[model samples]
Target chain A: MPRCRVRVSTWRRSVVGGAGGVEACRSGEVPYGGGRFNGQEGSEDSDSSVNRKSYPTTLRRHPSRMDQSESELKRFMSGLTLAECVGFVIIILTIVWLQYYRGGFAWSSDYKVMFNWHPLLMILSMIFLYANVMLVYRTFRHERKKKLKLVHAGLFLVIFVMAVIGLSAVFNVHNTAGTPNMYSLHSWLGICTMVLFACQWLCGLLSFLFPGVRHALRAWYLPVHTFFGMVVFILASCTVLMGLLEKAIFTLNDKTDTPYQFLPREAVVVNVMGILVALFAGLVIFLVGNPVFKRLSLPEDEMLLNEPIN
Target chain B: MPRCRVRVSTWRRSVVGGAGGVEACRSGEVPYGGGRFNGQEGSEDSDSSVNRKSYPTTLRRHPSRMDQSESELKRFMSGLTLAECVGFVIIILTIVWLQYYRGGFAWSSDYKVMFNWHPLLMILSMIFLYANVMLVYRTFRHERKKKLKLVHAGLFLVIFVMAVIGLSAVFNVHNTAGTPNMYSLHSWLGICTMVLFACQWLCGLLSFLFPGVRHALRAWYLPVHTFFGMVVFILASCTVLMGLLEKAIFTLNDKTDTPYQFLPREAVVVNVMGILVALFAGLVIFLVGNPVFKRLSLPEDEMLLNEPIN
Candidate 1:
């Protein structure tokens, strides 16, 4: 076969077919034309039980002297099992301990922030945010000019911004520079962020359903998918905010627990977020329909031995 | 062009594959996958921004002038814009109203159930069970045999059994007619469900990192991707149980709330869930790394678009 002399760097991006500096945005995931794999004709014929156990039919046979195998095994034998047993015990102990110390909900409205369980929820929020942020940062470092870089950047900006906002709220300092109600700003940015978030999901939906969108944004692969992850980050911060706010409003506990006092009154944000989430869910269902249901199962998502569909 | 006497039905089936099943599962918008023939290469790339913003775009364009262009014009006029407007309005109103109605979190000792804020959440559990059971029925409906069907059916059966146990706990009606915690049977199933969920996400992750899995699964395809989705279904159901358990303990309110009379004396379960959720969050991070602020801007992903390398 005659080989085409394509530059490694040049060919790296020859897939999506976008334009200018923004070459990453190519067609959607679906090709304008289609393909030829038909699965309908002999649909899953099987005589096995519904929950068929592993059918690891040995397809190859290699003769090995049992004596040699035993001797080699003896050479590799260590206290591996014993170590694992101890490790398992440690994990159980850790979980049990957490249940005692940092277990259940604890919130107090000693601040004007009123109803924010932010401090309490921060325990989980911090872990999630810190770990996720680190992973995202490292991925960026490794793939600098990667396909979907814009998408990755767009998502990280959102994550950092939220983290900052959450921290300030936790410490009772305004992080947005110049803003009071975080209400109006939060409402506008939240809605816009929500819209962008929807676009991110739609991009994936199109990748599987529309083709053009998939191939349009370069390979549009992982980076863009990472953008979809922005949702989880937003969720963590918001959940923490909700938890914190719960304390602020209800004064679940007073100075007896911490140093803070309640403001006037405001306890409606959680409901707003819940409504947004539910509505977003309904809209996704409407847009993607039945296919969306299958995707909703994050666990089943592993069946995707192929790249993640969305 | 030579035309062979081919069965169009078979050809279409082969071409469509999992998309056909998804099509069966979803509703398609009129444009199919949009128009404009995608323009030709070397025809000069238009500003997608301006092109996107052009008011020439209209929804519900009723073009009755003539011929094929007539349908095209009509479609152009009757496009996505206007329809989305109406949909957006409805979502806003519903969410706002729901938010207005949701009161502060309430506690209950009897573990009866709280149906206010999470009204649809509990119903979602039922819907999940309903969908699974129906799919199981469909597996056995027509073509008498299929290995994949049976395997998936086995999956559904496990879900069904768990759901039954869960429902029994909720309504106080188990087959054995036990007094309480009938749903404890579901907890054993939870481990299996979590494992399966991990498998699904792993499949998705591997599709990207492992070329063998990608090539074999055609990491590019959707059908192969949906396999992971099935596992995701069971995992999501497990969360419903968590939600219910959370609600049960919610009756206790916060530890800071009161003298602890209205609260359920059983505080152990709440603590257990918190630690479990924390551990789960940690595990999920291990599977899908965190998103945050770092050298997050990537460029490799942008190389695939076949455009000017920035």
Candidate 2:
């Protein structure tokens, strides 16, 4: 496996040569590359002493100096937690909007009901799970880089599968009802988002995961990948908002007893849901973009990551 | 008047004590704080030699090192230009959508035609003008900071006025037609965007313009201001998209001869317009958010900015 190819000797050399010096990380003292490259693949039980000893002298030198930075870190953590909570609220709102106001979900038997699955599944795949995947690196900074990559890729895969199903549900309903598909602006943008997302995932996989590229190439591509990830996420979010508006207008028009323009109960719920989705997307982007919240690379982690494995 | 209060002696002292050393910028060599705080307020003629001479030796030491960064800066410039082009295209498309597909604009004479002004003016104010206002700092990085602030505030004031007219157009139509107001999700979110935009403008004025806050408070609020600026822009974009969808559905639904679902010419044009708006917004956000494109503070500018006059 690629994980095993990371040379432990290189890490040791870098650590010994680091500012902490060889004396700081003597034999059997730092637990050999901080238990990450010690042939313990997938082991979650990392040694606490390794973490403490691996910190650079600059960080450990002034405990009082870290108070402001520590509080900033805490704010970032709380922001992330709040984003997750908002995400779940959006999910719950979507469910309630579909179940209580509109009819509940179904399969091919009921085309209208099948359309309900589209919004729920797309929100789950595109907005909620996709946001979490973007946060994995920032969230689990202490974890092994390889493990975090695995989790990121794995969540993306799940999102892709759900997105595919979501697309299928909408297409199936359109075909069954003999209605035109991909005609509206929502569908046009939605298709673009989907294609870009798939391409982003593939690029990310090739660059960072299996059959990884060279270190120089990976470094060059990393920022591009991150930039496109945010772009695709935003495109998806906009598509969803448009889709919600379209669905709300179509289903709650003048033909209905309580039309959308009348500010009916269901219309208000859908509007709130759309607003929440936008809020969630905005918060996630802010958390990712703010430099203060960025995940700092530890010395040991950097040593391991910089190894010329690829 | 506030600009005159900046102490030029402080900048001279800081420049003399800088790493380039006093020898690099002797008396009459640096042109006295690079001609910024020399009471020549609002003068557009900044000395290019002063700019070249004021650069730190670390930057000027390696000519080859400047090549890559210079190319990156060129790319950022080109990206901003491209975003501006896209924004203009969006405005033109909105005008066409309003004038050609929908009826032409009017005042109180014809409520239906008056409604047409809403989309065109909203797009002009919120999308086109707003994006350009955000790009002013990056576009005119070498300009006097106070002049840029004035330009920024001036452009925003224009946007605010246009937005007010845009809102009035819609409200006038709704009132004259005896229809409801602020009922749709589009109107709700649009109101939210307008309110937030006004508040952001006020905060910006109070913090950076007349009677400015303390430097420390301004520093703390700068990022918050920037973060909210982006959020409000995105919210505005979303609202515009929703408004487009609402109008398209309302005017081009099954009740019309060629419904929206039929992929009519108007529908396709509207869809393309919406997509262009999204692209413009995304490109603007990228141009603004990408760290590579951030406006670098000149040494002279830093000296003047760091003055404790505020």
Candidate 3:
């Protein structure tokens, strides 16, 4: 009877001990088989790698979102970055060209910095802007059926329409000089661009907030979104510069002026070419620095997510 | 040996019968104990009244939730149950007055018939618009430190300021007819309204979609939202009419045409008053709606969930 009692006591003890082990496994006090610590159980060790796998760094993690990277970047590049780079290079080239072309003919301010020739530069930058927009167009080309593709198409249409009207005004019709009903069209185009840019920015914001939604498009959609973002920046800069030229820049000769550009040509071309390189560089950095790309590049880093619902 | 065999047979019979009895109970046949079915019986039908206590009729549920007799007549009148009979009479009387008086002088077609007076409607609608906006403003009043509230305030300020400026142009500034600068301000204000409204609407949409968000502000927010929606429609009607008047009434007459009131003098005021009352009534109906009122009044309906997470 004593031997039987001893056996029962041991059996009871073992059963209780086995149940406690299962509970410990559930609470994650110590990882089963992943024993980095002394096999002594009870306390939990939460590694940074494990925690990072559970929760990610995202725009939600960003402490500040109110800052409009888009608006600020467009303003900064147009007002400062492009003018500095292109202006320096042009000024150096102009001085050299002047020295090289020492004909007895004197150059008037109009001849030296006529708004008409800047139309050529405007066309060049416009082509660059068009090219940028096209990159987005091509990336999302495969996404013919997506709802967001409508947004993409609508957005590019804004820039394209504005560009068409502005080009018509600059080269063909000289609409900016206020011939008949053209200024109305120019003004309407500006309004259209403003609306389109606002919608695009909102979409971009939604994308940033919800990473899962960043690409309902394929592997190329990131490049597409990024491309349009740059194109929009380019187009918005062009629009604002055009607005400034129409309202503020050309009248810089007044005594009331703090002086914008010395010979600030408001003729559409110079207004639009002033904000590209900086946009390109900043966009590249932002794209390259994206964590999605980092993960894509380093397949091993994504291994943390391999286990299902761990 | 015969006694042992008999005892075994009786035990087997009892086990089989017990299993059948349990299955019958589980299958919901003879549910109330099924005690006598296997023949270990009591007075089987003694107290059905005791059993009646277990199943409460649907009519005996919550008093407020019940469909009461005679009070079904009140359900046809939205929110009529809450008001005293006198209040219901007053509402009916007011509706009758509105439908009768809503015409030329009562509603002030001075603003309505002429496009110039379009601002009159805008300026008037703003009084109620301000009221509705202010009510919503109070709900977010406690959330003063939130950036979204600031955005909302900015939105209101933009709309109010633009309307004030536009109305001022219509009434106070006669120079609105000629000067490009005045038109520019009008243009700027219009653009500002478009941008501000887009932002407000998008932000409002996000707040409405996210119920668990502490500052969702949706239920209290919707009446105001609908109120603004109605106001927008009213403004659009007035503005579009004004646009037509600019082309039709003002354009046709020119500086030479004498301004003449269409209707006889006394009839004018009555018509104008009628329009205003009707507009307000319609606005109110479009906002909260009768169904919402019924739900809101219910104690368990929890329409305004205290935790803001419904």
Q: How do the residues B196-265 of candidate 1 rate in per-residue lDDT, one tens digit apiece? A: 5445445534543333442324323323334234324423433433443434323444445541223233
After superposition, candidate 3 runs with Cα above 4 Å error: A1-113, A119-239, A242-310, B1-159, B166-177, B180-310
lDDT of 3 by residue, A18-56 (tens): 222211222212112111111111111112133234222
Tens-digit lDDT track for model 2 on A93-128?
999999987789889578989999999999988999
Candidate ranking under DockQ, highest first, comes to 2, 1, 3
Higher-lDDT candidate of 1 and 2: 2
Which candidate number has the best DockQ?
2
- Candidate 3, residues B210-260, lDDT tens digits: the string is 346443244334434443443343333222222322222222223343321
Better of 1 and 3 by lDDT: 3
By lDDT, the better pick of 2 and 3 is: 2
- Per-residue lDDT for A177-210 in model 1, tens only? 2223332111222333334545654554444334
Interface RMSD, every prediction, one decimal place:
15.9, 14.8, 26.8
Q: What TM value does the first chain of each candidate achieve?
A: 0.25, 0.78, 0.27
Residue B160 in candidate 2 has what lDDT?
93
Compare the candidates by TM-score and give the number of the best one.
Answer: 2
User: Which parts of model 1 are misplaced by more than 4 Å?
Assistant: A1-155, A171-231, A234-275, A278-310, B1-145, B173-310
Per-residue lDDT over B100-205 for candidate 2, one digit per residue giving the tens place of the 0 to 100 score? 8777877856998998888988888888788777777556654445666778888899899999998999899888888889877678778888898999999988
Indicate the docking level reached by candidate 1: incorrect
